[model samples]
Target: MKKYLGPILFFAVFEAVAVTLWLTMDHLFYLFNFTYIGGSVALGLVLYIRKWKYARLMVQLAVGLYMLIYLGILSRENMQIEGFWYYLFLGVFEAATIHYVVAKIAGPLLFGRGWCGYACWTAMILDLLPYKTPCGPRRKLGYIRYITFGISLLFVGGLFLLHVPDLEKVMFWSFFIGNALYYGVGIALACAFKDNRAFCKYICPITVFLKPASYFSLSRVKNDTEKCVSCGKCKTVCPMDVDMTDNARRRKNGTECILCLKCVEACPKHSLHI
Candidate 1:
């Protein structure tokens, strides 16, 4: 029962969100959507606790494909940063805005970057690449994310400011093109840097929102120094170069942790946990 507590708690939190939105918004889609995503995530956590190796990948595919193909492509909901800006300018509080708030913004205060590890459509594919861990020291190109963030905001703001015609159609097409660019750039950067998360480290504009809230994340990995041999295995396996042993809010790259648990698995002394 204790072992299953994490999954139960996760499911309960999402269920509360699902029910609240469904009733308040009077939309059955919210009920179905959040429930499915929550169920898949809970199932994955259960599998992970059971030592199933592919549990994370399974959840990523389930949530990523649903959001990317079903919601983005077929249903025509753009769930990207551009889409968030597009809807924000239009004063629409549904769809992409709601998603960003839940998954990337406020939600990180509770779960950190769990969405990056488990549900991001972009990272879903990137994680399948050759480099599960970084090959070298982190680069100083982090400033790129701020630039990309500005570009996305400006692009959408430009459209509204200029009163672009057929704005709905434009947004739809932008979603397609933006995802293509992300996938292309993400894959290329991964191969070039020998790091599967290179794109996430330097290019993803959503991190502009994810990082700040996650800095105060209630859920985080901690290391027990008494049990730790200081062999440096946790840092070696961390995809984001997070210093898990530090147990400080300002630990090196602390905001970059995606809760992937790779470091936890690599810890030889069983000193790391969330």
Candidate 2:
């Protein structure tokens, strides 16, 4: 019963969002959308508790493909950062705008960067790269994310300032091209840095929103000092290079944690738990 609590709570939270949106937006799509995503997440959590090795990967694919193919391609809704800016500038509360609010912004307060670990379409592909754990010390190149963030803002703001015609079609194409660029750059960076999450750590603009709220994430991995034997296995396995031995919210690279649970799995002493 205790192990089942995590998935149940996650499913309930998503269901609450689904029901609220369905009633407020008068659209069944909201209900279906959140229900499917929430269910996938919950299923992953259940599988994880059962000690299934690929549970997280399964959830990533299930959610990522649905967003990338169905929503971004088939439905022609750009769920990327640029799309968020486009929708936000228009003062609309739909599509990517709502998505950013839930998954990238407010949601991080509760779940940290769980979206990065379990659902990001970009990471869905990047995680497939050969580099799993970081090979070298973290670089100072994280400043690149700010540049990318600025580029996204300027690109979309430019379109609005110019009052471009056929905006929807343009946004759809941008979605396709933006994703292509992400995969290409993500792969290239992974090869160069020998780190699977190099793009996430250094290039992804969404982290700008995810990091701040995630600093105070209610659900995060904590270190049990009593159980720890000073083993460094957790640090070596951490994809984000977080200092997991430190339980403080302000621990080194704390906000970078994606809640991947790699540290927990690596700790032979069972010192880490989420």
Cα lDDT computed for each candidate against the true fold: 0.95, 0.95
The sequence of per-residue lDDT tens digits that candidate 2 reaches over residues 13-65 is 99999999999999999999999999999999999999999999999999999
Per-prediction TM-score: 0.99, 0.99
Model 1 lowest lDDT segment of ten: 86-95
Which lDDT tens digits does candidate 1 get at residues 1-274?
Answer: 8999998999998999999999999999998998999999999999999999999999999999999999999999999999999888889999899999999999999999999999999999999999998999999999999999999999999998999999889989999999999999999999999999999999999999999999999989999989999999899999999999999899999999999999999998999999
Give Cα distance to truth, residue 246, candidate 2, Å. Answer: 0.3
The 10-residue segment of model 2 with minimum total lDDT is 230-239
lDDT of 2 at 218: 96
| Candidate 1 residue pairs that clash | none
